[model samples]
Target: MTTSTTGGRTTVADTQNPPGATGGRGRSARKRRAILDAAREVFLRGGYLGTNMDEIAALSEVSKQTVYKHFGSKEALFVEIVTSMTSGAGDTVHDQLPQPARGDDLAQYLREYAYRQLTVVLTPDLMRLRRLVIGEVPRFPELARVLHEGGPARAMRSMAALFERLADEGRLTVDDPRTAASHFNWLVMAEPVNRAMLLGDEAIPSPQELRRHAADGVRVFLAAYGPGAGHAPR
Candidate 1:
């Protein structure tokens, strides 16, 4: 929930210029990376339906044929970018939720996972993609579904598993972790995330503010179903 873990920035850093006389193959690879970066920017701005390869090629300073050679189609390019943006963080989110052990700390694990997820969700480009999906959902429902499956839905599954494991370990009493995880997420991102996306990131919440929201969500969640809640693990 805190900005400490929020991936607020998504700026792809420029690779250092190769020391005198970069080779042709190396140059081509660099160009490919540039193309991917440009494609990401374009997709974030234009969404799937609105983006075109020509603009991406122009932004990447490559010929249209080069773009086609690299990705083949707009959907392919968008899928690749979505995979890149969402998958890496998915791994991190899973890693944050280590398997629950006897006497393992549940609140601590939730806090860590919540913090990491908050960071990933708040990442500017991902945030833009979230907005794009919402705006385009009426027209392109599949795109929204794909993004959800790739992004938030995956995150929810990871959290759900963690919650289920906790219940198994007698740390919580969750009969349906999918619903529980969804509630947990809504609580964590309830304030800052919605404001960030709705306000178009015009006002980035402070780290302190983000942390406060996360902490509050954790507190309330624990009070509801954590350690002392009736229904003990069977």
Candidate 2:
């Protein structure tokens, strides 16, 4: 590498990659991504018990040794995929839920939030994940608890914090924001989420159906939590 000073500004010149530098880190990262992507696809199709490391390796176009080096085990890869669902392996997770009250109309905010929530939760990836959990949970009941506590429960806590904020702002009256959050979640999610879980990937609700669900849930939620509903704030 060389630098020249011109007009009191330093300019970089003749910068180049060192010989024998094969971009090891970038290649490793791409391999890891391929493994995760392949793992997600295989698990979604085969469930945790049925998926194997060789198939994942083959699908990823990486060697079995490479897959083992990257992920260590099938269970480890499965856990990573499951955890990433909540923590955002993608863009859909965070934006699906509402942030703390931001001066939007309560009804409109709730509707939009619920609709996005439904949209995300009802996706093929999540629905397949839910089915995988169901299939695995009977033999490993602890996995059920792990999935619930890690994924949906985390979302509930976030929503509860939003409800608490709404209560503080006098946008809603709520004695128990956790319960309020649960109510709102179940109101919008129960039927559609369950249907997709039990039926198949094709069981997702239509956009019009989702809109109606969100609107109805907002109406019911506001009826209880709206100002002057007068349950006497605790």
Candidate 3:
């Protein structure tokens, strides 16, 4: 048995499960999921230093010992939370990417792609997470790195891959798929993401607004990259 205090109450857990026990593994996985969910809420609400393990344990319905057993320390838990959240979001965006078929309308595909990216990334939760990570960078530089690698960097990679395929099919003329991906990404994301980040959730755009922005971005991207554009001077 393991005992710990949470919110001035004593909480206990059965710790005697033998190694390689299936039930034990299932229970451990459940506890870990609960801890991550609860910790994300607490950290988002309170920031890093303000958050407490006791609160997380209480909210998660687990003993504080279990939280520590799973995550070791508050710092470790924080890193895991940031990494998990960003990676999950990145995976979602990557998985939902539209499969570009030959002869599909490039402008329509680009607009849909841009709009989808915006919709996935411009939510209140993700925006708040981004701000939170940015604020903590001085103390936890790795958090920023994780956010960038899992979010924008991952998105750019996916975009570049699709662009490469399109260019191969003669739909676009791309000297550098990576650079073109960056241009299209920022063109769709920069204004809206910056607005939401700096001005708060109220600045997040509506679907109609996002659609308009996506259309405009696709137009510019096609002007420079669409077939017959011929690479457009670097």
User: All candidates: CA RMSD in angstroms?
Assistant: 10.2, 5.3, 9.0
Candidate 2 per-residue lDDT over residues 1-234, each given as its tens digit: 788899999866534545534577679999999999999999888887789999999999999999989878887888888877745622364454546446677799788878887888788888888778787776667767767876667667867888888888888898998999899889888988889888987788899989998999999989988988887756
Task: Encode model 1's per-residue lDDT on 1-234: one tens digit a residue.
Answer: 122323776433234435544476678888889899999998888777778888999999999899888788877787678767777667776765566567756677677667777877787877887787688677667777777786768878877887887777777888689988888988887677778887977655766767667778998888877866765344
The clash count for each model shown is 3, 0, 0
Q: What are the runs in model 3 whose C-alpha is more than 4 Å off?
A: 1-20, 232-234
List pairs with backbone clashes in candidate 2: none
Q: Using lDDT as the measure, name the better of candidate 1 and candidate 2.
A: 2
**Which residue pairs collide in model 1, if any?**
1-115, 6-119, 7-119
TM-score of 2: 0.85
**Better model by TM-score: candidate 2 vs candidate 3:** 3
How well does each candidate superpose onto the true structure, as a TM-score? 0.77, 0.85, 0.87
Give the number of the best model, judged by lDDT. Answer: 3
Candidate 1 segments whose C-alpha is farther than 4 A from its true place: 1-31, 46-50, 96-104
lDDT of 3 by residue, 39-101 (tens): 999998899988999999999999999999999999999999999989888877788665878
lDDT of each: 0.77, 0.81, 0.90
